[model samples]
Target: MFRSNSTTDCVQHITTSVELTPIRNYISELNLVHHSKRVFKLKLNFPKFIVICNNNGARLLELQSKVEENWIDLQCRVRGYGIGVWLGLTDLQREGQYVTMSDACRPRYSNWMRGEPNNGNGNEHCAMYWITRSGWNDTVCKGKINFVSTFKDAMIFCNNLGAELLELQSKAEENWVDLQCRIRGYSYGVWLGLSDVRTEGQFVSLSDARKPRGNFRNWAKGEPSNGGNSEHCVIYWTTRIGWNDARCTDKFNVACKKQKEIAYD
Candidate 1:
């Protein structure tokens, strides 16, 4: 009887293992599908605004009826690129709500706090700048100055800052700066914004006196060595060096600058 029981247990173990094989394979396939789905969502759901500030500020702005459920899908168009106090304040203002001037983009500010307000209290009136649900965040500051508030009560804030804002706006529209992808065997670089040069060493000059030539030189040093009889240049932005060059056909991240008009329909 003992020998018979031992034989029975061995057969059961083999049967269980075989049964689990298909289940395991199914799980692996499911994970792949889940990952692909996530990438699809990201590509489809690109944030309109490159930057957001005051996590609480973002949350308060989202509370608007038009934004109640689909706030993340709303692309964020701010006054500037990257995260900074200017970008943060511009983001909040662009939302068209009353914001504490102090809440403007301070790098040290908390993202978590920005999203959720009054962690310390239940009754504090949230400071915000109000704008129509359909209005663009920058529109308030763009023309006619519809609402009035102070960045600080005692200090004077100038609208000339808006000129700088306009410059950033133009840069974004031009799409001249693009990011390049890493190549298989080469150090990462970007494509300059030029094409069809007559000479191998030719480079483009900046139209604006303040703008730097040679593809974000301060950011990408020792780049654009005019690699081996290459005559064309493409503009690109790099995380490590700001901007630099590679061969025209090389793939990289692109910064396309265009004024995106927000239409609430």
Candidate 2:
């Protein structure tokens, strides 16, 4: 098992992996890597930025407290400064009600600059951290912005590796996921790619928006109650030994699968 505390080993792994690009400033405390700028050339509008990060197994950086804020600031001073980086915060749903994208959690601590979040031009809906000032600012969501990303969340954990959340298309695939988890001694269930977020009770694959083929579903008995309509995402329930609807925001291990290229005869 890779221990996050083993900085030397972590750095070695990151250095050797062509897929990994360590986030420049704050790489020590968090084992995060910035996705390739080549994917979007370092400039993307807020929504696209979120999508890009998600596609690459990452989430936009979130600052939980002043201590974390200071760590980033100090690292920026040590490395160098850029224009700024987008945060995982937005008020798109309701003005003056900024929320984190991962869980819709309201920030318990904030370091907004004085007179900030003024909703400038009545369109600044996304939040960013200015490297030079070390303060937060709300900005226009339409404008392209460079950003720092974190390999947080199950969706991101898989996407970061050029793969996607597992889709159990058959009993064989489902059994494989279960056997792997059991062999590895996973204490909890793994996330599945299916979800009904866009339309209630209509589960679709997150990677490609494909519906399940030919009525193949292994839902656990009494599952998918859509409890409070909050449980939109699906997980392979380890305890129940079948699939169940779950809160999308909650963290879990993920089984990622990438299609293999088949050679033509």
Candidate 3:
């Protein structure tokens, strides 16, 4: 979670906050790295910056491999940690106020250090794995140590065939999506990306809130009742051919989704 705040851009985790400013009149280019066990290098214009994204290790192993090597723990682990991404809002103009970048990753899990990201002196804008530590931290960007990055923009989490959490674009898309889930052997039910997780009826896609609710047809004719506000997750009810909100804890199949990779020039 790299964020830019008013004074500095500090990379924090999902829950923590940071401030940043926007640069103007940008130029752009795009390149894709399609290989395994390779450090992804993204060459963006500003100052000729280079970002390396990774995606081969398991959840915890991914973080560990970055910091622990040769049985020697460096000062910080440099993978996927940084306040590099510009939140839509920046503190460059307004100070001390900040909002989180959009949940483009929609992480299913997180490991954060306690009371972390104090942003001491406002220099710690990059996300890093501190030495002798189990969680993560925000630190100054300039350092000799390695850094972490992710290839979220170029990849989508789906089956090899590209089957994923159904995006309900229209009634027809919805109908086709059900078949995709069923073919995948999710007969019991399927977990949808939609949820009232943030608010009751105004359900939003868990991955990117900006995604319009679009045309989710009648909720199984009588579903998504909010269930006393206990149900926050949504799912496609196969039997009903309509949408339903359910307890997030209640196990069910899930739909995979990705947001349009946002790039500014």
Candidate 4:
């Protein structure tokens, strides 16, 4: 059973290396550093810099959407620095198979410069923000560059623990989970494994890619409106009986599930 005295606990199994303060605003503070010439001269490689970010309770930034790009541009304007910055994207695992360092998931959105990501010299595996071109460019991982940082999300945290968001397949299972939460005094909403991320209006289980059995739906009244056209993820809105569509990025309680072990006779 999962238990947390805190106001938020994405999942019981997923524990963070560093304590993170609960976000009070939709957008947490973005840390985009444009270090001094002396620091830039250090020429630290990608691996070394990633360690620094982790040690400081941060991660190499991942630009998942244009909103983040615009956010970076806004920061650049305020700071008056437009040099390239290191992004958390890389094809180190496999050529042309870029994945974000924050979650090892393929970026849902990318802004590659025209003819960019050419994997120049066969060594350009890391990605960087091309401020001049207003897009991304693959570059050498050994190159010295500035970087950005942001906190990780619940899904990533759960994945790190070898579990996935909870998926309710039957009314009995849903009732059991709800009962457990009530018994544990958990009152906040919790993230579920259901989502329509791949196709609008087509919900599926993240664990098995299956639809709800019997087409069971417990959506709250007038729910799943996909408010702002961004609510693709589903969550238990304060209780098990009521579900709501929400932004995948939004922070909420998480309930993860792991398959039970089966023993051969």
* Model 4 pairs whose backbones collide: 10-254
TM-scores for the candidates: 0.25, 0.42, 0.35, 0.41
Expressed as tens digits, the lDDT of each residue in 169-246 for candidate 4 is 667766766654443333445678788989998888776778865677788888988999989988766553677888
* lDDT score, candidate 4, position 105: 87
The reply for model 4, stretches above 4 Å from the true place, is 1-54, 57-152, 261-265
List the global CA lDDT of all models.
Answer: 0.25, 0.61, 0.38, 0.60
Q: How far is candidate 3 from the true structure (C-alpha RMSD, Å)?
A: 17.4
Pick out the ten consecutive residues of candidate 3 with the lowest summed lDDT.
25-34
Superpose all Cα atoms of candidate 2 onto the true structure and report the RMSD in Å to 1 decimal: 18.1
Q: Compose the digit string of candidate 2's lDDT tens values, residues 1-265.
A: 1223321211112221212223322232121112222222223467775666566456667777776677666654442233456678899899989898888988767888889989999989988877667798998877643211211355665565566667777887677667655543343467777888899999998867878755579999998899887999888877678988888765454455667311000
Candidate 4: what lDDT? 0.60
Better lDDT candidate (1, 4):
4
Candidate 3 on 1-265: residue-level lDDT in tens?
Answer: 2353322112111121322122211101111111112112223221122231112110111122322221122211121111122112112222323222222232233334687656668754444434345554554444222111111211223332243344466786566656654443333445566666666687776446744466445577767687876887666776677878777655443344434221111
Residue 231 in model 4: lDDT: 91
Pairs clashing in candidate 2?
57-156, 57-159, 57-160
